[model samples]
Target chain A: MGEFELIRQYFMPLARLHGSSSVIVGPGDDCAVQRVPPGSDLVFSIDTLVEGVHFPVGYRPDYLGWRTLAVAASDLAAMGAEPSCFTLALTLPEADELWLRDFSLGLGNAAESFGLTLAGGDTTRGPLTLSVQVHGVVEQGGAIRRSGARAGDLVVVSGSLGDAGAALDYLPAQEDLDADDSAAADKQFVLERYHHPQPRLDLGKALRQFATAAIDVSDGLLADLNHILEASNVGASIELARIPVSPALVRLKGSAATDYALHSGDDYELCATISEASWVGAPAWLKQQLTVVGEIEPVSGLRLDGSAVVSGSEATGFDHFRRKA
Target chain B: MGEFELIRQYFMPLARLHGSSSVIVGPGDDCAVQRVPPGSDLVFSIDTLVEGVHFPVGYRPDYLGWRTLAVAASDLAAMGAEPSCFTLALTLPEADELWLRDFSLGLGNAAESFGLTLAGGDTTRGPLTLSVQVHGVVEQGGAIRRSGARAGDLVVVSGSLGDAGAALDYLPAQEDLDADDSAAADKQFVLERYHHPQPRLDLGKALRQFATAAIDVSDGLLADLNHILEASNVGASIELARIPVSPALVRLKGSAATDYALHSGDDYELCATISEASWVGAPAWLKQQLTVVGEIEPVSGLRLDGSAVVSGSEATGFDHFRRKA
Candidate 1:
């Protein structure tokens, strides 16, 4: 089948079930038209994942589809924006029906899970790559930002860290975890965490009410949290004991678990700051999701366990072009 | 410098100038937050230009950047939407400062020309590729669509067609064009047409009031007009003599100018259908921009000068995957 025909048969049907009131026009148009909610500011972000660079070359098409949306949507979570619609630009080496079908299914599932409508996109032929641009809405001037943190604010993170980073070791093995091994279950847990990161949309929404500053942890805790400090013009003192390290990470890295949590990337957890008063007023569910990892300070540099987290190899996160650094 | 630093130094400067009231939060945050004008619908589209596939592998970075945004913005023009903001997902093999600077300058020029703001985007490492997602705004329920053409509607096009397509042959010999040669000047004009297409945004917005249906002629005139026929479930009788072929194309292709105008792709002109009453009432300047190419008919297929434009090879435009077909 031709490129347009394939998209019509596989991708167009995926746009059918997800109905949003804001959408005026969906697929099969030069551009998709939708209304931004009244009294809201539309938030948009774009991310690209190239095969062999971002993910495994022959990774599961369904998983890649889900991950592509989830990773991009994590930025919306960071901005505390409500999911609205998204466009997907898929470039493939060839038109493989089976691969396209699986990828479309996963894309549909991600859109449904995130409450995002498939507005419009383009399908082209090239090296396998996916670029997704997500649009969401937040109340005007209400988006959580990295520049809002202040001294005396508590830094908190949702869920555990290090699990996704640790999963890198087992991702290539894919469905080949030895069922008899003692760490198989833990390996599976981390692998799933790495492959299908659940963007903390609900938590992000709740934080918009009280969080002082927010950033999603995609490039490890130290790297991402540093962004907040740099933007907010404040230093931070992170308590080593407070960093959340998953059991899976401990199983994989043991004494090196802290390294994975602090230095490895692709962990889609929210690292945010909350004033002490706001933390006290937070609901039980939100409190349960958040774990205090650090405190904002008046100084101008980051500290880990009261010692400076020196820059260079020790502190830098994922730098795509400067890989050797 | 790392990717982040490169973006901060180069792209961030481009983001500083285009201040729009619609922007609540711009490029620095996880997402760019903007407000669509009160009574308007948001229209968005994405396009990717891959190395060696869409353009020559080592084409001028400035031209690449400009063409990228122009191609994406053409979709907005086709939808009769006003430019708002755009996010760029740029993947590269390395962090080359000179290339990025020139590219960002071209991007800034395009955004400024189109009255668009640079929002949030991701920069990553991979094969050189660019994915641009443009967001525009149109009055709610006012967007032009291909499906809206009626049997008695007149088919019209904005600007001349096929110059860009015809320029493809001379693109490789760009620097060798002799200034003294008449054909060389024509070649230069078509080459500029190919490299820096001016997306007809103003013309599109003007047509929203009168045009029943619209599409950008990206994949040749005959091919794109066929899309209108398919979507409106109507047929068309196009006058070969009426097809707007540029003087440059006629100079280059001679007798085959008609073929280039009909069969070649990347024209980026708007093909719109207008009611007879609306056509009569259209402003003088708009009338000057638009040319009568055909008339929509009650039947369900396309005709060229009283002969059927056969399906398959004779009718098909550029298909990404089935390039040879």
Candidate 2:
């Protein structure tokens, strides 16, 4: 599709929305104009999901749209930024009406659910790639960062992980968790995670009130958390038993089972560090919604109950560019 | 390089620049947080430059870094917003240190050249793609939108067009430019426009004082300007004889006596419209530096004399996605 007509059809309408005072100008100009509240900081992040790479190709457009936006917003959750606005850059092969309609509906639902406005975006025809620029606001000086995790911090996670990764084992078109969901609870859990992964904005904002360091478990618990540890230049000995294994995940044994949660890349759960001297209890919302998985330490290198954990590329976690034939 | 090292070596240092107050929270987080002035609004836009799409494959990393940022900043320029900060989602196949060093330098130079600072970004192992998210600010209720152009408005352009399109004949390498660059002036001018485009942030902000509507000339003079006409529900007659042609472009088009400037893309110049009543002379910085290319009308459809523009599948000018053969 020509850029003009495609943009006019999909984005022009998104631009005309119920105006908010904070949104000085919405999707039509060179930039989406927004106002950070008096005591807030504007938080921004950019992510690109390439076709045949980030997501399986020929996947349902609606799910793809929901997942793409959700994946980008999860970063805000990781940083404890309250969602406000987002801009999407969509590059597709053509303006397939069916796909565009479903995708738009999916995006609309996500935007509505997160209370964010589709502020601005660009539509182009390319190799079916989607890049999302998401914005949120944290209190003037309260946004949590990966580098803030120091030694003696308590590491925790929002909700369970690995279900999205597990969902990949099912058929690609299996959009619903219940449809063809095997008796395997783990399988169902994985499918659910894939279909509707949650962004823990509530838990993240609560952490801004109490936690020290945080990150979303996108790459994996070990790999992603290792980033925090590396940034903080320290590590911890996790109580292997403290790991919150979902019922589906707990059933699997050996490398494959643990690999799903440890290195599977789609989980967007937040992996955060709390101050040892901070309050002993979490907010009720977080408590009902999250699981305490591990604690930070003064040591270097990741470990499970004082033992180091091994990584299996399983061809799952490595960068696709360098992947060998 | 791995993602972490790329951040530490290429991005973190740039993000640490305590330039303006907009950079409240920089890199080292899931998102970059900035502070918008009390009476100001945040302006943002996202654009992606893909290899073999936006630019020729095997193009110089330095120029790639520069042009990508320039194009995205041009959007800010169109909206009359002041450059504040930017985030980049860089996807590359392998860890090419030398290339990355040059790319980072170009990006850093561009960031510092404009008032914008490098806030935060994502570097992943994938196809060679650059997604830049640009942030700017406009005073409360002071920004330009395409929909603002109306009947009886003067259509204007900031600079000469088509220099970039001509330069593209020398693709992927700088050698092709050597044969064409018999004269020093011609050679340097062609290379400059192609490699390092100027984002007219100053003129864009200045337009807020005198222009009725504005947009950056990205796709082409005919296409991008038509965007204004379509949005304003008005048409315009542009004098092809009055179209501004760069010195290098004039020399290159001497044989064909062609006016590729009317249809060529990648100019990054600002195209605007001003009402006859609101029309005032542009600032000195703009008068000698910018061009008043044409005017607007009350009818619809873009025209180059008597011809109507048609969409296509070309990879360069106006190529949303050039299909692979």
Candidate 1 lDDT score at position B48: 91
Q: Number of clashes in every candidate structure?
A: 0, 5
Model 2 misplaced stretches (Cα beyond 4 Å): A11-21, A150-152, A171-185, A252-256, A276-285, A308-325, B150-152, B170-174, B177-188, B255-258, B275-285, B299-319, B322-325
**Residue A28, candidate 1: C-alpha displacement in angstroms:** 0.9
Q: Return the DockQ of model 2.
A: 0.50
Please write out the lDDT profile of model 1 over residues A137-205, one tens digit for every residue: 899889999999999999999999988888888887867889999899999998999889999999998
Candidate 2 lDDT, A192-217, residue by residue in tens: 68866778777788888777888888
Candidate 2 versus truth, CA RMSD in Å, comes to 3.9
Off by over 4 Å in 1: A311-315, B311-314
Instruction: Identify the candidate with maximal DockQ.
Output: 1
Pairs of residues at least 3 apart in sequence or in different chains that clash in candidate 2: A125-B320, A186-A248, B1-B95, B155-B295, B235-B299
TM-score, candidate 1, chain B alone: 0.96
For residue A27, model 1's alpha carbon misses the true position, in angstroms, by 1.2
Judged by TM-score, which candidate is best? 1
Model 2: per-residue lDDT, tens digit, B226-281? 66776678777777777888667777677332356766667688888887665655
